[model samples]
Target: MEYVVSHIPQGTACNRRSAYKMIPTTITIHNTGNPSSTARNERDWLTNPSNARQASFHIVVDERQAIECIPLIENAWHAGDGSGVNSGNRTSIGIEICESGNYAKTLDNAAELVAKMLKERGWGTDRLRRHFDWSGKICPRLMYDGGNWTGWKTFVASVDAKLKPKEDVRMPEEVAVQVDGKKVGVGEIKDGVTKVPVRLVAEAFGANVLWDAKTRTVNITKKEAV
Candidate 1:
């Protein structure tokens, strides 16, 4: 889930392609479309001075590693949408999944990166958008799965599964309770907190329990120290 920073150097080309700052509101995924290029290869091409295409991406991922060629805070030209207020290029973090190597692993890696970005920005899976979603371009073609929505759903489901919070199982079931290594009673978990019968626990600790009938309350006072 980590990446190497290889930011595109500031230049006329870089400026023209991704000079504008972006408060990324969404994430866009793409497949490099070049099936034999590695992520480093894609990053090199994107950052190369000879490359004049108005196309760049924030990140590139292959089976081995992920490389970041553009800052996420800046806009990249991966999304073909124009620079309007709602343009995907202006408000989306673009990730190009390289198709060179182990394609399935690359997809899983891309899903991992997408899930991380969503989690970091507090975005839901709904914020995930494909290149096609923005400009009708069948990108990340593997995920496109012959233009089937089910294919996209499969990838989205992976990200969604990663986004779900880990379980905080405070108490699985009633557990044996003990006072000073001696069994006293059982404790039950309620709302992440464990509850134990006060009478048993108090008496186990050498405390006297008194019931106040006037207020219908029970109070326990220590009978001895230690």
Candidate 2:
């Protein structure tokens, strides 16, 4: 999938240099619980840095539209600790179907988008289950307390009906370079080192290069680029 940089709030940050190196086997659905529009939710995650709760998920379908937050390759902090373990945060992708403050149409879209996500991910109905199944919490209440689990079931069933193994897809170019940090992009790697160009080296990180053709010496400045 293509990575697009949008308006990310300041608070949303990752704790590590690389994405959580685990392929998620679960999907977690959540409710914002505070009822927020798509923009509001994004803002809250970004601007409220002090809250110390920074995370993202694969997708969020809300009043505005389905937002692609944390890229599919990275981990998002959407799962919360319940009972004992944090099941939904990193090892599982999260979908926040906003149900707070009055916005509700997102429910239908959330269901549809989830089905699409499941199909795309090649996860079958057997792998599909509610977050409560893992943590025993009343979240995404409409799916729990509202007594209409049919939506979730229908989505899973659709996934199962068309289950087929996806072809062995080649890893994306970005996966090999180990540049999951902010603002880093895919580039060629040579001799166990990605030889960034003298001119473009600055783009990767804080570094200055002085190319002395006579001495074959290239001075590089090192610091955080972004």
Candidate 3:
């Protein structure tokens, strides 16, 4: 879940932070569409003013790592929704998954990152949207073209699985009881109760333990201190 933050400058033309604010109600996922660029390269390209004018996103994820190009609280011109008040650019956090390197691993990293964002924003998997959802463009083109939209569903499932709570596991430990600095028989915890043999404990404490067969009872006696 570790990510690199190489945020774009505050007043960069690519990210107009003063014009609009972002509340991040939704997470929009995209694919870089470049077959040879890594997340770092994408971040660098977005940071450059010459390349920043066209489009920008909050983060770019690859197989090995993720890089943040823009702050999540500000809008990046990624959604291609044009100039609208409720455009995805203004209300969503955009993430571009790099197509370079191991495609499957990159997708997994993106899913993990998105799952964390969902948990932080208190959003569900329902809030996950594809670039194609906002506009007719076939972004994350690999998932759409390769799996015929089924891949997107599987990705959402991965994010949902990550959000699930994990079960707690407890291992039993052997409990030991000591008397007068001497080791005695081991005790055990069962059904939330500690069980130990009374005779063993009494004998370990230098007490005389006797069994009465007639009444079926056990007795212990310790000598008084001199």
In angstroms, give how far residue 186 of model 3 lies from its true place: 9.6
Model 2: pairs clashing at backbone N, Cα or C within 3 Å: 9-46, 11-46, 35-100, 35-101, 55-77, 56-77, 207-221, 208-221
Give me the runs in candidate 3 sitting further than 4 Å from their true place: 13-19, 49-53, 172-226
Write candidate 1's Cα lDDT for 18-116 as tens digits: 478788899988888898999989888865778778788888999988998888888888889887867999999888988877888888998888898
Model 1, CA-based lDDT? 0.84
Question: How would the candidate models be sorted by TM-score, starting from the highest?
Answer: 3, 1, 2
**Candidate 3 backbone collisions, by pair:** none
Pick by TM-score: 1 or 3, better one: 3
**Residue 125 lDDT (model 3):** 99
lDDT (0-100) at residue 208 of candidate 3?
81
Better of 2 and 3 by TM-score: 3
Which portions of model 1 show Cα errors greater than 4 Å? 12-17, 168-226
Number of clashing pairs, model 1? Answer: 1
Task: After superposing candidate 2 on the true structure, give the runs of residues whose Cα lies further than 4 Å from its correct spot.
Answer: 1-18, 54-56, 81-86, 100-104, 146-226
Highest lDDT: which candidate?
1
How well does candidate 3 match the true structure in TM-score terms? Answer: 0.72
lDDT per residue (tens digit) for residues 130-154 in model 2: 6566566666666553666766565
lDDT of 3: 0.83
Model 2 CA RMSD to the hidden true structure, in angstroms: 22.1
